[model samples]
Target: MPRIIVAEIDSAEQRAVAVDVWRAANAARRRTATEARIRRIQEKLDTAELALLAHYGPRPAGMLVAETYHVDGVPLPGYGHLSMVFVDPAVWGSHVGTEMIRDLQSRGWEGLSVWTRTDNRRAQRLYERTGFTDTSNRSTLRDGEEIMQLAWSLSET
Candidate 1:
């Protein structure tokens, strides 16, 4: 079993471990534009309202970031945003990501939302299995990539 720890965003050590986990988790998908992706991840980590790090014994294996702000033009009340969730590929099927989501849900979130790359069907399936539904809301990144927003209501859990 992995140990889940709330990240100390201001701590350099935790931030470094989180970045390493993020890189390993997204290694396959981030085939190019490495520097840009690293920068984006760093920015997200720095600004996340909450962050969690999962460790398998002594090794960092996963990370999650939550933000409470509403997306531009989208009105969400009592909803928290799941800004990022990444588990090392080596532990892809170990349920770490699911556990993280469950942990978040247990915190009494009225609703939670996440944005995933439009082409990331695997992530979509995982979210759906965890009770999230497509909100049909789309957003484009500065790099012109499209993403879809998914939401889960605690009342339905």
Candidate 2:
């Protein structure tokens, strides 16, 4: 059976995993993000308007980051821009990602959004399964690579 827990990333148990996620994301993208970059990300996490972790048992399996902001000049509810939902990759297809999303949804998030590279079909599918719909919008990463933007809304039904 799969287990999922939602807790603040500031928790002692989650600190290392948060940094690990940054490393994994950078490595997966083939970017040479240095220790400095990792520290900078940790700093942001420390002050992260909102940060949450998705845990499997006693392990920090994944995380979510929400900047808490407005879009298109319109005020909205809590907007969680999902980031670094990385599974250890050693255990791919183990439903870790799905469990993570479920945990996040249970947090009562409403106007959530996420972005994935056009070529990252795996991630796109995961987001879709979690009720995120592609907006057909595109943007470039900080490194100049093209990425497709996707969004999700918690239905009132």
Q: Write model 2 residue lDDT over 16-49, tens digit each, in one string.
A: 6777865765676677888787887777677776
| Candidate 2 regions with alpha-carbon error over 4 angstroms | 72-75
lDDT for position 132 in model 1: 96
Clashes of each: 0, 0
Clashing pairs in 1: none
- True-structure Cα RMSD, model 1: 2.7
Q: RMSD (Cα, Å) of candidate 2? A: 2.6
- CA lDDT scores, all candidates in order: 0.79, 0.71
Best by TM-score: 1
The residue ranges of model 1 lying beyond 4 angstroms of the native Cα positions read: 1-10, 71-77, 142-144
Tens digits of per-residue lDDT, candidate 1, 1-157, equal 6664434356667877888888886776765637887899888887767787776657677788887747596856678889888887877776677777777777778999999999998789779988999999999988799999999998988
By summed lDDT, the worst window of 10 consecutive residues in model 2 runs over: 83-92
Candidate number of the best lDDT: 1
